[model samples]
Target: DAMVIQNPRYQVTQFGKPVTLSCSQTLNHNVMYWYQQKSSQAPKLLFHYYDKDFNNEADTPDNFQSRRPNTSFCFLDIRSPGLGDTAMYLCATSRRTSGGASETQYFGPGTRLLVL
Candidate 1:
């Protein structure tokens, strides 16, 4: 089935180390998003790409960055990993239909990061 997929489901990094997470999809959607979710909290939107247009959430930290090299692939780069930065990174995709409504976003399994 066409779906979003993330690599290296589990990652371990040291304090101040840089880490990169990746996502890819077969769904050919126009919008792709990255979210950071901490324990017992809501998933926070980090950034997204709407057909090459990049949009970053206002409150997302400077250390968090994203790149969508093409329609099917996106990457999340943490410039400097910290202890507090350990969380589940989720990637999703969706598109607005001709009916002028947004479709439901399909999410990947997610990548869990551990900082030591």
Candidate 2:
């Protein structure tokens, strides 16, 4: 029963509208990550918070942002969702307390967004 939970598996919005997707984990992991995956392509890392240390991928667009206000919860915010922005938003976590790197990341089922 202890796992990540994401509200509303599907989201539909108009282009340019702001949208938010949420994630919460019961794993008590120290690192939480957000990824954007489109059409079965590789999940692109957007950003992550490692114990309040936020790391964003270099090429990730400015339209994407994240907030991890607490240990258990994280949110992905799209300032302006575009048609090309439609994708599955995935949330992941790792304990990663031993060092700065960990290969195993537990992922949420994901939130699918459709921009019209």
Candidate 3:
């Protein structure tokens, strides 16, 4: 069973329009991540927040921003969505542990954005 959930499974927006995607998790994970995946391309890590410490990928565009108001909720804001921004926005959650071993991430269904 997936603990992560993303709202607005499908969305359509106009070019240059601002849009927001929401994600929430049932499990109280310490870390959350946002990824953008274009068709036939690998998902790119936009950013991740670990217990209020936000970390953005160096290559992530400035148009993308994220907020984690609380432990269970996170929001992705696209200031000016473009045609190229049309892609699947994925939300994932994981627990950060002291061990070096990799932790498994629980992913949401993802919100598909279509910019016209």
Clashing pairs for model 3 are: none
lDDT of 3: 0.94
In order, candidate lDDTs are 0.93, 0.92, 0.94
Candidate 2 Cα outliers beyond 4 Å, as residue runs: none
* Runs in model 1 lying further than 4 Å from the true structure: 98-100
Cα lDDT for residue 44, candidate 3: 92
Which of candidates 1 and 2 is the stronger one according to TM-score?
Answer: 2
Candidate 3: worst 10 consecutive residues by lDDT? 97-106
Model 1 lDDT per residue over 1-116, tens place:
99999987999999999999999999999899999999989999999888888999999999998888999999999999989999999999998687756699999999999999
The window of 10 residues in a row where model 1 has the poorest summed lDDT is 94-103
Candidate 1: lDDT over CA atoms? 0.93
Q: Residue 62's C-alpha lDDT in candidate 1?
A: 95
Best model number under TM-score? 2
Question: Cα deviation in Å at residue 104, candidate 2?
Answer: 1.4
Query: Per-residue alpha-carbon lDDT of model 2 for 1-116, expressed as tens digits?
Result: 88988877999999999999999999999999998999969999999999899999999999998899999999999999889998999999988757667757999999999999
lDDT score for residue 74 of model 3: 98
Per-model TM values vs. the true structure: 0.94, 0.95, 0.94
Candidate 1, residue 7: CA error in Å? 1.0
